[model samples]
Target: MSPDIRDEAVEMWFGPQHVSAHGWAAKLTVVGDFIVECDPHAGYFHRSAEKVLEFRTFKQGPLVLERMCMLEAFLAEYPYISAVEQIAGVEVPERAKVLRTIMMEASRIHSLQFWWGQFSAELGLFAMTLWPWVDREFFLDTFEELTGSRHAVSFSTPGGVRYDFNEKVLKKLDRALQRLEQHLPKFKDMLLRSPTFRMRTKGIALFSYEDALRWGLSGPNIKACGVPMDLRKDWPDLNLAYDLVDWEVPVVDNPDHPGQSDAYDRMVQRFLEVETSINIIRQLLPQIPEGPIVDPKARAKTNRLPAGEAYGRVEGTRGVTTVWLKTTEKAQTPYRAKIRGPCFASYYSLKHLVPGSTFADFIVVFGSLDPYPGWWDR
Candidate 1:
């Protein structure tokens, strides 16, 4: 290598910090204030969750799976549980389906608010961070009241859920979500609607729609690119949730360029998903049936299926999360498990996006994508 080129760039490390929220450890090659290249390290966060799933009984697996991400624990657990149920040929009760839908929506609200808070916090908007948590508490309260625990409830099971959604609790949840809707405008004004925030984010970190697709982005990331791709919308009637809920997949293409997606659009997409969750919660509560929450014979102790394999997927707050389960005849434990973590694609694509941007812009881009580093290199 030429001495001049070596002098042109210097290397630096972003993190491998003991308590990083995103658990990232990246090495960057920079020229002055601009990043020339970035090589992100991943092993620091590998949990090997798929391998761990093989060691636990079907009912016990979710207990560990929920540990993959703190903010979206329940959402991470859903795909795997759905996989197990499918391979076992388990039929969920109508009431249980309703309960699952409600819980999934509620949990999604928690995750959206979480990322909202993190996004605000990243920009030094501490007050906005606190504001979203207040709304998120409404959903967490509902979880605690219904499932008897807050995070990692493990309430979802192969046949159905571990508990029923009581009418009174549903009423309480409805009231809480309605209250959350009332406070949305204040946050919009503070963050998304703020002129300063727009100036910083609107024209910055713009990626082409094709680039978004090539990088395998999902959730708000891809939606912001105008792809309108959603597992719920693409896969018909996986259950009744997506089909019956009647929700639109929010798409946010670049305003200036008309065909691109930007950091601001990603934030806008997230904000819209928050509103959609409220709508979903309201729609499902009244529709919840009065029936058994679980099928008696579908309990894990009695699960003895013929050897087979099945895959299940669901749209999570971050994106589409998929799980594959293979079973041995009459075995209560899975012979193998494979997980498709939502944040992994974005994690790998960071190198392509980070170069040629200022160090200041780095925070904006990373904060916008918001990949949970725990999901990477695993």
Candidate 2:
């Protein structure tokens, strides 16, 4: 409590060891455990992914870039593939369109499952992490069986999904969804009754509706703040006309608890979204039409996009991720390409959240926000 000690600079090695440190070592500057500053010493697992993409063929980059974030493979690839397809002027098949919608929802569920689990872990609740991961694994297995890879399927291509499905695959997806429906209520009860979890997060790390809007927060962050701007329902053009599918955007009324966009509300909103994603998958599966996976037999093993500039974006696992491609008129390689990740906005908000809070609260707030650094560092 002495003023001299308080004013003295102190540095600490906070974590390269924590489970939620996002696979990097962080050297945090602490004014006695309050984390006045943080320097993220990134690249503990860096593979020079962005640079490597240039060496790979256009078709090959999809697989390589998908690995940029293990939890967000779909969102990462969707934009890339969409951009390539746009430059090539290829029309995606209707069956492929429906499949992309279903796959995207499944991927969204996978990432949110991880986020929900981590949110509970941050609150010191272990069961919440366990149950949802176990349930989500079923979908992972389904993706693996369908696409030949679980985490980074590389299933999507410029024009359509790389593969098609059969009746049996649909049946399997239906069964897994049925299990999710059955167990979700139990998961809800566990979170609802956990007094400590509720107390720790209920009103902490609050963000107002204005704060969310000002910061350009989307997905569950917006939903948690009592806004109903779901990309699937509200902005269908983003997904190449995914509106034909029937689904509801879940919304909440928290005017009494106005500006109640705290860690608790964020977690609760994700839980609700997990349910909505499951419903979307269930509804989309049976209605999926029978058709060829890809038609016209793509021009070459590797696609050469036309020389021009195009930016494609998709509502990803975290929020909105965009890809900008500029091609030289004749060259097979891209002249320039850019990836815009969603986590940057969420991470930037830490400046606003951390100053007045204690260190443990910092971890709780960061984990609840679920800013995946692998995507950001890329």
| Candidate that scores best on lDDT | 1
CA RMSD, predictions in order: 2.0, 2.8
Global lDDT of model 2:
0.73
Alpha-carbon TM-score of each model against the true structure:
0.94, 0.90
lDDT of 1 by residue, 277-367 (tens): 8887778777877888888787653366568888888888888788888888887788998888888888777788888888777777877
lDDT of 2 by residue, 147-262 (tens): 88888788787767787776666766776687888987888788866888778877677887788777777767767888877656654554353666666777665665875588
Which one is best on TM-score? Answer: 1
Number of clashing residue pairs, candidate 2 = 0
lDDT of 2 at 334: 66
Give the count of colliding residue pairs in each prediction.
Answer: 0, 0
Model 1 regions more than 4 Å off? 1-3, 18-22, 237-240, 300-302
Instruction: List the candidate 2 regions with Cα displacement exceeding 4 Å.
Output: 1-9, 25-46, 213-216, 233-235, 238-241, 297-302
